[model samples]
Target: MPIDRLADLADAATAPRLVVKVGSSLLVGPGGTVRGEWLDSLVRELAQARARGQEVIVVSSGAIALGAARLGLAKGGRGSLADAQAAAAVGQIALASLWAERLAAHDIPAAQLLVTLEDLEDRRRYLNAAATLARLLKAGAIPVINENDSVATAEIRFGDNDRLAARVAQAASAHAIVLLSDVDGLYDRDPKDPAAQRLARVEGVTDEVHAMATGASSSGMGSGGMTSKLQAAEIAERAGIALAIVNGTHTAPLARGLSGEGIGTLFLPRRRDGARKAWLGGRQRMHGVLVVDPGCAAALGRGGSLLATGITAVEGDFGRGDPVAVRDGDGRTLAQGLAEYTAAEIERIKGRRSEEIEALLGYAPRAAVIHRDQLVLL
Candidate 1:
């Protein structure tokens, strides 16, 4: 799987989707102000990518850094996690508005999405996120994504935007993920070492690659380092996505990476089009169970939608967009789909016709309890 840089450029230029991850160092200056000019250039890069028929999704980090100085936690050793979390809460507003403003200049609508690991960890939430992100892409809007650090504890948080970006790329079915970082690419040893060497490309992230891993960075506000980027690269590789770690200091950073200019290390996936199916077939854990009649089970097996009429009983107090299991009367799992209605809502609509939905609940979000596209038959 040795990557052909020029080949990658050609392939990526025609790719339907791309996810670019912007580290905090690229977004904020040492003075703690948003790097407007840098962001403007990045926006222009995205605009050009869009013109080439590529849908661009951005995962930006800098919220906590943006808030640190403002909260008087600026002049210090890396502050506590709680302090960083507080900063993230306040900085998210600034970060979102800044992206919106920058992209607006090019008539590119930027939609902000703040997510935690839980959003992608839970099967239902992952489906819900995938659907919403897909909708935004279909509507010709660029998603400005960021990690939700405000409530994420160390045990539950992704910690770095790199891994989070990988998950976003997988969920969005992106063709490539460009990690815009301070460094140019992977090195044989610490770049500071006199004998260090930079590898232009890597085919796989093996044990040897892990041995080359470094610790947290010294230059930026981000907590992640080259080791984390490699970790993220592996995730992208497993999902059949190409990952590039390029220096964000340069103008048109993403463009250079995708154009096959050999600006960074590119990690190629082992296979194309099958990683997603294999991952999905791994039996994702679903939260709730919905017992349906035989007819409903047959319909599901045929790739039809789950309707309220087919539902006979519900178990578990789940909310809208939660993944629920579809089972038969004997309790055998039939399929799994994200719920359009909450447990209570489903309870009231069970065994009711689509026509009776509006009258019973005064309104219906959708006719089907679970859309056909979201349901996965077991």
Candidate 2:
């Protein structure tokens, strides 16, 4: 896509549902204080979008930075996982309060939504989260989302808000995702070097651009780098959500970028899947593994349902109605399905006939371990 064409798309996006992600570096100033002026400007733009009748959700990163400032841990280059977690706990409160005050100034109410990987990974949780956000939007409130860093472990972490933003875009059925970062946009090489040129628009992320992206925050306040931003863009693109990476430091960049000013790298949206299917595809995180026999694996590969007799072993502690990965005995994942039986139930009845399920479990809600309609072959 050309820069001009992307400018046109951005203008069209003004009234569409949007998910905007702001990095920690952009939200905080030197000495770790909230950049009041920057946030005020950003909020003003968001208010404008809302005035245009666009529903917007913000995925913001700055809790840890604010927490560090509040705790007087201002000059550190790095910290332990414990330190980061503690900072998040303290800062999240401050972050929400700050946003509330800012939004109030514009007569817009802001709501806080703290989510972990499990919220998106679990189907029930995912639906609940989506419902809450949808209601907030319907009630004319902007939701400010952040990772629930207080209790997140390495295994169940979003790693960065960029990925979280993409997931939110998918959850909200957003039409676009605008990522405001330090750099103006993606470049063929390091933007710091004079010779490196800006990539004003990308129809799709190519191998060369993927290779060019490297490193985390030079400011030492956030974990996300250009690489993670690119990955987030890919996720949004796959879901047919338009994306923009603009310089957050610029004055009113969000509004300017959306007005066809051509100030960022614009990623064109791909052809989309059905809304329900796209939500299901992006929301479920692999919960447990069900090792199936070779015959079952082949059947599933051919888009067949998983029967009770096909499962050899169940791993992990997932409940009935949770998403589980179906793998062969060698441990390669063949498909993902909504398990009809709990892990405990599957363990007891593995390799049994479908007719035997009622007798063995006292009740059988489903004859197959996973019905074909709920299972997606990998």
Each candidate structure's TM-score, on Cα atoms with residue i matched to residue i, is 0.71, 0.76
**Per-residue lDDT of candidate 1, residues 127-156 (tens digit):** 889999999999999999998888888766
* Stretches of candidate 2 exceeding 4 Å from the true structure: 1-15, 74-78, 193-195, 204-209, 283-378
lDDT of all predictions, in order shown? 0.80, 0.80
Clashing residue pairs for model 1 = none
Worst 10 residues of 1 by lDDT: 275-284
Q: For residues 210-232, could you state the per-residue lDDT of candidate 2 as single tens digits?
A: 89897666666778889988878
**Model 2 TM-score relative to the real fold:** 0.76
Q: In the order shown, what is each candidate's alpha-carbon RMSD?
A: 10.2, 4.7
List the pairs of residues colliding in candidate 2: 121-285
